[model samples]
Target: MATGTGIGTEIQISDSSDEQVILKTKMIKLDTHNWVQWSCQMENYLTARRYDDLFMPPSEETKRSSKFRQKNSSALALLWGCVSSELEGVLLDNKTSFYDTWEVLGNICGKNSIVTICETFYELISLKYKPESSLQAHIHSFQKLCARYNSITSDKVLKATFPPKLLAATFIRSLNGDKELTGLVQTLYDIKPFTPAAVISRVAIEHSRRQPNEQALFAGSSNKSMQKTKWDEQKQRNKGQRSGKKYDKPGPSDKNDSDKRMDNIKKMLEKLQASMKPQSAHLTTESNIKTVVPTLMLS
Candidate 1:
């Protein structure tokens, strides 16, 4: 089997006999969310089936060959089968040849243009782990962005500018807000050969380890909220009771004190009147004695 396509491009032709690569498992269906994975898987499928040459532009020498036509047809059918129903429109007018369909798919879903590469690079670096979402989901999203960045960048002249180790570091950096996961990932990075798979494995173990603690914290917060509500209700009830009966108004003890003060003033006034009457009676008796003595002497 010719290893090279004689076009300065290196091709890997399988040593296995040219047997029909029957579909053993379902191929990954293409969707907006999974374009990176889909393209990667599709390329693997193409290479394995020895039909990857259909992806390249047909040279003048082989463009008219019947062998190219047969292989191109098979590759085109494979692409059409992999596309999801919603994205079927992308293939409608673009399916002129295998190369055309592949390029169109790359331009649309793969974002093969320079502008899209920049956008994808920015997205990959800025991808952060959301605390509200599951750890596994965040990791999955991180992996997708890394894969997407590589896929888009691979189309450029400077292919795969960022290495896998660099991508792993970027992923670890994305976990800056999470101390435990960051530490765990960093330790794994320092301790062993740091790959994306290793980071994911260690992070997953740490996440599972922390699950019970997270649940306990959530339950504790719920209990605190319930207690606060109960306290607020009790306070409102006490306030309502105090409002119903005015606590500041005079009570029975106050009224009794006022009555006792009035009785003491009345008793003091009676005593003063009795003493003045005695003084007046004594003065009158003294005058009568003087007059009686003078009359007896005259008799």
Candidate 2:
């Protein structure tokens, strides 16, 4: 018997004449154990090889494999199903491991996958798992649609993308207080910067001119009430940062208004004294006449 065969992993033969003969066979099956073992096996198979035994830190190669990076909508559908909609506590049951799986999922598919995944997962529960027989006719259709989309494989583009009606329908089905739904919405919001959001920014800016408002959004436009807010916050941070440095003693720029007024008075007095001198008499006379005539003529 082989070393791994003791727990039912391999096959063994009693006598072999050139050709191999199977005396006994062993296989892992769902009948004996629930999905826990199967899920673990699937997860391991996906993440086995890595740079380091302790931790395989992120890098370029790791990112390329993410389902999130590929924009595979199916990944989103499956994620929403398992985690957001809590498809039978499937994701939560092995959360630690699931998180590990999610890291890879996000790296490959792009985070948008989460929203679709959650929506699809909820549909699966409502249509197939829980609906009473009366409204259950579409159950098979639902599963059939989801069969190839469980979690989005990286190497293929088989089943069609869900149409907007179907996609939106699935998401709205379980509007259950699934916290992950918030994350999914956030992902959708972030990925749509190039679409209607661009137009929305222009419209919002026009509205801003008519009303007082604030938010640091609009990428380059003044609509960045949020950016302005952040800039203000950053300015405060910079002030604190400068305060921390061992700066030189305050310079002339730090002088008070009184000091500036005194300096201006001194300059004026010096100018008046210079003008009163013998050499400045002509200039003073001309200046005095120019100053007096304007007031006299106006009066």
Candidate models: Cα lDDT each: 0.66, 0.40
Q: RMSD in angstroms, candidate 2? A: 21.1
The number of the candidate with the highest lDDT is 1
- lDDT digits (tens) for residues 1-299 of candidate 1: 11222222222223234554344334567766556667777788677777778778889778788777767666665565577677778778766587877777766764555666677788888988765568878888887777677766775574658766877788888787765555565586684577777777888887788789889999999999999998896666557645763333334445674466445644654565467776564533545545644443344
Q: C-alpha displacement of 15 in model 2, angstroms? A: 23
TM-score of each: 0.46, 0.18
Clashes of each: 0, 30
lDDT of 2 by residue, 1-299 (tens): 32243333442322223236433334332221123333343345323322122123344564565532332222222233222222324434433333455454333333334444555555564642232222123333554545534443222442334444454345334332434334443444343343333323432343455233223333446645767897796566557545753223333343573366445655664588686868765644545654754343234
Local lDDT at 7 for model 1? 23
In candidate 1, which residue pairs clash?
Answer: none
Error of 2 at 170 (Å): 3.3
